[model samples]
Target chain A: MRFGVVVFPGSNCDRDCYHVIKEVMEEPVEYIWHKEKSLSGFDALILPGGFSYGDYLRTGAIARFSPIMPAVMDFAQAGGLVLGICNGFQILLEAGLLPGAMLRNSSLKFICQPVFLKIQRNDTPFSNKFKSMQVVKIPIAHGEGNYYCDPRTLQEMKDNGQILFTYCSADGEETMEYNPNGSLANIAGIMNGKGNVLGMMPHPERYSEDILGGRDGFNIFASMINWLKGVG
Target chain B: MLKANIYVTLKNGVLDPQGEAVKKSLKILDFGQVNQVRIGKFIEVWLESRDQAAAIKELEEMSDKLLANPVIEDYRVEIVEVNQS
Candidate 1:
């Protein structure tokens, strides 16, 4: 499958995502410029992490108006696979592709650390390789990743199994002590109701290799490949 | 010419971590009368249109579309200046 990693003005992790797909996964990957309107040949799209547009006004606000966003919205609406990581996740929320908004961390400081995540559901395309309730360690780096949504929307996502990953203890116990950003309900990741788009604050690409301290994130990429193959 | 001063703030029920930090600092200084402190963004936009009504409508659209996030924020716009020139 062909993968396209989007490069917004301030995006710094596009190369990391591209490397993971090309070198680690041995898949064809290309960098999609933010100004490009066409997503013609890509099988899946990735919005990597970084402070896009200098994170001005808001983290992802300015990047949402990029020329490529309308195309992204159309692609997602058509049920194409799209994964957003960190700042990319912020953009997805700003674009209304995923529900909720991101706010400053409760501590009011940038946090960069590995945190345990409890897989809430494995049926979705993003987590299909993980066992139910499995605990995986992945690093989160951001200043404003506190996710929030209305109670009604939260309930609906819960009902639909749209809530994918939640911050948890190494033992897979959900609690505030492990939540680095004080995200709503300790949510680390969520998927759209249609299950095509996923936005998560963790940097899976950063941990896709064992030399980077962990390979727990490799399965996320593998799951996508598996899902795509199944669909095809 | 018209200048619109817009204030964008978190909606009710959303926690303001930055404001909370400021409140803590204020408490350390012992002002004590402060019950709450919420921080928000103030944006000034200059419009070339002299028609106040039309300018206000355009400002509202700008706020709704880009200046403010309607999901978690509320924005108020005021025409602070109407240049006769």
Candidate 2:
């Protein structure tokens, strides 16, 4: 699989995501600057986490208007896979590629730590490698990770199984203690209606290697690779 | 000239943690009358065109595309035209 990682002005995770896809997953990876308008050569896209545009005017607000969003939109519309992590998730929300909005953490502080996530749906392209309700450990670092959506849309997501992941205890139990940002329904990640676009607050790239503490996140990237291989 | 006032907020059912924190602070300050508080953003836009329909269309596009995330926030556009002497 040829993965393309989007690099914005303040994207700090571009290299980490590239390293994981290229080295860990052994897939071809390329960097596409935010100013670029085309994504013809890549099969999948990854919007890495970072403080894009310094997180001014709200997280992901400024970066949404970057030049490359049109191409991202096109790629998503074409049924190609796209993953947005952390601020990239916020940008996806701002860009309307995914539902819900990110708000200030319930604790009102920047949280940085390893978090446990429960796989809610394994049918989507992002989580097909895991079984339903499986637990994975990943790091989450953000100030605006609280996810919010309308009641109707929330119901719709639940009915359609669009929710892909949720915060959970290390043992895979759902509890308020595992809710780092107090996200509604303890949501940690979600997929678009078509299930091709995924936005999550956790840093999967940070955990792709065992030396980084764990290799649970590798399953997600590996799932993407398997999906691409199937398509090709 | 046409002006528009836009109010953006988190949709109902979504927790407003910031507003909750502010309400708690107000209570600690002895302002107990505050029953509930919801945080939102108010934006005023000025348009050079006097065509109300055109301005409204542009504003709607702006709101739908960038001014607000429709999934979580609903925006209302109110246009007021300045009377010329």
Candidate 3:
């Protein structure tokens, strides 16, 4: 499947995502500038992490008004696969493609380290490669990755099985210490009600190779590609 | 010219680690009377409008759509009619 990585002016991880998907994964991938309005010919889109414009009001606050966002919203509404990582996740929250908002990390520091994530469920297109409750080591680097949502919305997401990943211990046990950002309910990632969009704070592209310290994170891409091959 | 000043802040129940850190530093500096500290953003938008009622409605919509995220933030808009000198 063709993949498009949206690149905002301040986006730093767009190259990382492009490298992994194009060179490492050997998939057709292209970078879509934030001002360009077309998303056609791409089966999936990845909003890689970074500080978009106006990191002032909030992480994704100003980036939502970029010229290309409306097209991205339309793509998502049409049931297209969209993966948002780190700051990308924040953009999705601001765009209303996902629930919740990001707050400063509970420690109030920029954390950059590997954290274990548990696949809460594998029913969606994103995590179908991993077993239920499977653990994967991914790196998270952000200061405002703390996820918060109203109680009612949280409950509704729970009921709809929209939560895709949660911070967990190395042994795959759900614990507080492993929650690097103090995210609500230890959530690390979530899908929209339709399950076509995913927003996760951790950077799977950062650890997509065993040579890079781990390969567990590569399964997410594998799963996405496999799902596309099957559905197409 | 009519200007709208908007303030967006985290909801009361949401955690504000950045604000909390500032509070801790203030305590270390021996600022005793301050019980708590919360941080928020203040923005000003200047637009062409003479009608206060219509301006207020438009500014509120602007804040809701772009200036603030409703899920975790509360925003207030104050309109000021600035006289052209």
Q: Which number leads on TM-score?
A: 1
Using lDDT, rank the candidates from best to worst.
Answer: 1, 3, 2
Q: Which candidate tops DockQ?
A: 3
Query: How accurate locally is residue A217 in candidate 3, as Cα lDDT from 0 to 100?
Result: 74
Residue B37, candidate 2: alpha-carbon lDDT: 90
Cα lDDT tens digits for candidate 3, A1-232: 7999999989999999999999888999999999997779998999999999848578988888899999999999999999999989999999989988988899988999999999998877898889999888899999998899999999999999999999999898877788898899999999999998999999999899878998777888888898888851
Model 1 score (lDDT): 0.93
Q: After superposition, how far is residue A146 of candidate 2 from its true place, in Å?
A: 1.5
* Local accuracy of candidate 1 as per-residue lDDT tens digits, A75-134: 999999999999999999999999999999999999999999999888878888999899
Q: lDDT score, residue A184, model 2?
A: 83
- TM-score on 0 to 1 scale for chain A of candidate 2: 0.97
For candidate 2, what is the DockQ-based docking class? medium
Q: Comparing to the true complex, what docking class would candidate 3 get?
A: high
Q: Which of the CAPRI classes, incorrect, acceptable, medium or high, describes model 1? A: high
Q: What TM-score does candidate 3 get on C-alpha atoms?
A: 0.95
| Candidate 2 chain A weakest lDDT stretch, 10 residues | A223-232
Off by over 4 Å in 1: none
